[model samples]
Target: MKQVLHFINGKFLESTSGKFYDNYNPATGKVISKIALGSEEDVDKAVEAASEAMNGEWGNIKINDRIALLYALADEIDSRFDEFLEAETLDTGKPYTIARHIDIPRGAANFKVFADTMKSVADEAYQMDTPDGGIAMNYSRRYPKGVITVITPWNLPFLLMTWKVGPALACGNTVVVKAAESTPTTTALLGEVMNKVGIPKGVFNVVHGFGKDIGDRLTSHPKVDAVTFTGSTPTGKRIMQSSALDLKHLSLELGGKNPAIIFADCDMKKAINETVRSVFANSGQVCLGTERVYVERPIFDKFVNKLKKAGENIKLGIQHDESSDMGPLISKDHQEKVLSYYKLAKDLGANVVLGGGSPKMENGLENGYWIDPTIWTGLSEDSAIVKEEIFGPCCHIAPFDTEEEAIKLANDTEYGLAATVFSENLSKAHRVAGQIDAGIVWVNSWFLRDLRTPFGGMKKSGIGREGGHHSLEFYTELKNICIKM
Candidate 1:
């Protein structure tokens, strides 16, 4: 089994606490590795290292050199793409296909995009003529917020970490990343890539372990300048409170119960495929997955039937099984958490139109934390199953009589992370999308993302954005300079 250690100051270090957490493979419920569980003391050491780098060569490196480092890192990731794909699948229990096609490639893309963006970063300036015929000038310069704490979630572990790290490093800020305890292998691999690319020591660090053990200390440390986290809403709240103690800059991408609204005038076949892809692609573990699907009453019955068929066809297999469409949840505990929602839906009289239980597999795979893709109907908008984030391969379907009702249903949940509107009518699609409260809205499609666009959530889903210019802004602090001539 692999033994994972903390990555501090460009070296793998043993935990000072001499404590470790067993990392499991959700596919087989087997212990694959033991990750070093860090403590407050470890966090202090990391912060101290990062502080030194921030005040030294890394903080004062030429912008061209920083951009070149980012480019080199991206190239390294691309060259080792297959290795990353395998490790990501092993660590997260996602299908090998997804890791290859989506996660790993996007992670590399993040670095490339940010590196290119750095060359175009320019300061803003304004000049005014004074009454004495002299020129007065005001200019704004962006500087890195040193020593940022990047805490990423288990789902899309490497991809999400790169989403923050790419921008943070490009902006010249040093980072101490806390990879999720459930999946740390890919992140450990990233540490290796960082070293290979010759990123300065302490400029990038990775600490493995649970959030409770070290997350609080990382966010609350006096020297930490900012915290960028992607995880549960409850944890986001905690980070918010703790970071507020020192008034640290915070960028959080939290939980969501996203909705998919299917209009009757839509292309039925595409809608069915995209809707299923939305919820079952990552076994519905995505924060932007459409957990609550609202269909126009005219086509509701047909849509639900199609969704049920798609769910039934989803193949649940082990991570390396290329034939599989989906894989297990991250852990047995998460599997149970998702299963409880099925019971709740049943108790609320929601019709289990499709799968509502775990699947029994052959070839020694029965012990995995696997759940069959499930579909439900006959549930009210306010039902617990509809309003809450199941974060599994399950979805609740309901019919809406009018456009206004569809809009209302889409915006009903506390989360406003992402929503999808599928309709053949362009006017209606635009109309409904505009009215939706989500930060990202898809029209006639799902998961079509542009790296240059702003990505974030609204309401309780999250605070701040993390993509393109928004990311650059979040990782930096602005200083204004004024001169009279």
Candidate 2:
């Protein structure tokens, strides 16, 4: 049987239970492989293995050596780019452009950055001579969380995993990565690369199982010193509650219902282009993807028409085709859920401007799940379609006459993850951007991220943050040493 198995103890091993589930290719609706289904028992074994690896091999390693291992893993991944992309395409249903260019390349680069960063970490001197008083000295250093439980989501599995795994390993911590059931292939593939790069056995581990079955065990595992997760809000709540038993440290990158505003003084053409890219890119499955768009009354009609036309032009098909712009949703179940949201929009009296239905499977995707890029107009901030994180190619547009109204609508949602503002008036842009309650704001750009950039949400979106300046801090603990004389 074609199989996708777990990676444990630096080796790809068959399931302990010997049970496997169909791993389907969303674009073709075919079972590409049989992924081993892991249970709570499997999680326990994996955690125990990771714990041993941490205390034995990783715990004994020098800081510099750990950094070198991270750098080596990055180099190994860089060398096998194609192999990673092929497996990613099969597992995640993302297009070639995304798998080959975006996720894989960036993931490899992230490890390299972590490696370099780790090498430079040193205790900060906190001692100074006093003219006529006794000397006082202080310094700060880093401590690794012994073991981390990484619970990642389906979208951008490899890339998101790196944002967590990179820092965890760099800090001399052992890891147990639980990938989304639909997209565990690339992460599993990384295990081979990790071993080839010389990361010791038990230092790194990957488990394949549904979140419902194996999740609680990992989050509450007494041995787990920290938990880093990327998923839905409800799920994050559960993970946090479980970890509360031990009050384990958490790094959560959860859901978002982000917004983009177009001021009356904005350049309409530029706004339209960015609006399409912001909402429809990656089939709008991004956590930071724009779900609602607010426009000024003067240009609202023109912007909506242009955005509607642009949405209709998006191409959805197979993952391998270089010309194909969009691939299937991560799975059939997700595809159906996306369609249901669109259906609910109609029920709530939201107007579908263009391409509001599922993408036809006739276009080479005889079986995979695909949806046409869609747009909704005349939606209010209170509309269910506008407030929720659809996590699909769905964008709702609302018009505002005054600047204050636009700001109100932008910050109306419970989520405060990301937002965009477009305007010829720099002052106006800055003013509106400030009033918007997002963690990150774009003056003219959207969904732009640097490996080192701090990324996360506020309010119900999530707690804590990820990326740059703060990311490495999440995987470590700060201890201060002081002496007085």
Predicted model with the maximum lDDT: 1
- Cα lDDT tens digits for candidate 2, 1-485: 47878888877887888888888887888888888898888888789988998779778899888888887888898888898888888887888987787899888888878777777656587777666787878888888878899988888888888878998888888899999998888888888888887889988899898888889999999989999998899999999999998989988877889988888777777888888888887888888888888888888888888888887777776787788778878888888889988898888888889767785578557777888788888665677888778899888888888988888888888888889999999888888888889888988877667656678888878888766547668888888887786
lDDT of 2 at 91: 81
Candidate 1 stretches with Cα past 4 Å from truth are none
Candidate 1, 299-378: lDDT as tens digits = 88899888888888888888788998899999999999999998898989989998898988778777889987999989
Give lDDT for model 1: 0.89
Cα miss at 314, model 2 (Å)? 1.1
The global C-alpha lDDT for each of the candidates, from Candidate 1 onward, is 0.89, 0.84
Error of 1 at 217 (Å): 0.2
Score every model by TM-score.
Answer: 0.98, 0.96
